[model samples]
Target: MLARLATLCPAPILQRVDRLIEPLRATCSTKVKAGSVKQEFEKQDELKRSAMRAVAALLPIPEVGKSPIMANFTSQIRSNPELAGLFKRIKKDSASAPSTDSVELS
Candidate 1:
């Protein structure tokens, strides 16, 4: 639903939503314990990856009118190798997938 909301919202509202989603990374990291299992850590990483993908879709490819909030997020993705790989994978996946303005709720 958050992803859907991002799709429908205008730039200003999307900036607010971007702010809300940005902290997910920190929360995912701080919630983990020193003794936590590897699987638990992987789960949090996956959650962050999913959120990044959703936000990445909102930024322009050439970034002509990019919002500063989103541009900052984009720079973070670029600097992190693991996140960069995931971000690139989504862009490749999206290019091969069919484009549609409508959402499939299922």
Candidate 2:
């Protein structure tokens, strides 16, 4: 009778379930609050922009069309409305520069 009862009720599977529940009990007891994840992201981005300031002004931004270049570009465009000079500068720097493709794409 004992041999028949042991076969009907498995001990090993029940012991394995207890092992799974032990770790889960810790997770169930503690409650974590979600806070401003965006603030964390903006803080990181601010760090990145400020980090670039460490380099000297002579660094030329490596490419064009970015803020460093656009600030230069807008000033030039504003001075001369012809746009020929701007187009030439765009072609020269587009490879490393940010998207100067808006003109060509259209």
Candidate 3:
């Protein structure tokens, strides 16, 4: 009955139930020992920590805008007289391209 109850309950509630039943279980020949229960809890904690570390390692680091190298290169281009003028001309040409909003209807 306690085993079934443990399955239905959340971790915190299940832990409390385990604590409540510990003395009764200790007296029962068929029940698990307190040391075994403590070992199981430690194993579960280690598994959770390992899973969290794996997830953190798999995720990419986030930063605002372009990467450092690209950002530095763009800044350099904008600061140079010849490159800055060329970049402005290209930007203006791209901006002047026809937009879907201005499409003619037949």
Candidate 4:
């Protein structure tokens, strides 16, 4: 089962799997003492929960961008100090004095 799971897991995650599971392998091995069995089971349970959460995140949400939702987010973001600074920067750039080159004749 572990071999098959290791095969299916993505490489980046699998790369560190041994480091995580190896130390506990002696206790978790069916042939060995059961001292690390609890740790191994907990690890498997955590992996399952994490996978479920990832799958849930991938599910689509309908009405994800209703106008009221967007308006609320926009208002909240607009209230931010950084947003205010950005707005000031934009306003200052637009309202700067026109240069001689800007008034060039067509």
Please tell me which predicted candidate would have the highest TM-score against the true structure.
1
9 in model 4: Cα distance from truth in Å? 24
lDDT of each: 0.56, 0.34, 0.35, 0.35
| CA error at residue 82 for candidate 1, angstroms | 1.2
Compose the digit string of candidate 4's lDDT tens values, residues 4-85: 3333553543344334333333322223236768777677645533332221221112222233433343344346554334
lDDT tens digits, residue span 72-106, model 2:
43344345443434334434544563332332201
| Candidate 1: Cα lDDT at 20 | 58
Root-mean-square deviation of each candidate, in angstroms? 6.4, 27.6, 27.1, 22.7
Can you list the residue pairs that collide in candidate 1?
none
Worst window of 10 by summed lDDT in candidate 1: 97-106
**Candidate 4 or 1, higher lDDT:** 1
Candidate numbers sorted by TM-score from highest down: 1, 3, 4, 2
Q: Write the per-residue lDDT of candidate 1 for residues 15-75, one digit (tens) a residue.
A: 4644654574464234567799999888877787676556554543233125565555556
> Which TM-score value belongs to model 4?
0.25
Each candidate structure's count of clashing pairs: 0, 0, 0, 0
Candidate 3: where are CA atoms >4 Å away?
Answer: 1-64, 98-106
Clash pairs (backbone) in predicted model 2: none
In model 4, how large is the Cα lDDT of residue 90? 36
Model 3 residue 36 CA deviation in Å: 84
Candidate 4 ranges beyond 4 A from true positions: 1-36, 61-106
Report the lDDT tens digits of candidate 3 across residue range 1-106. Answer: 3323333543544234324433322222133446677876666545433332221221112221123432343355446564455444444443554221121111
Off by over 4 Å in 2: 1-36, 56-106
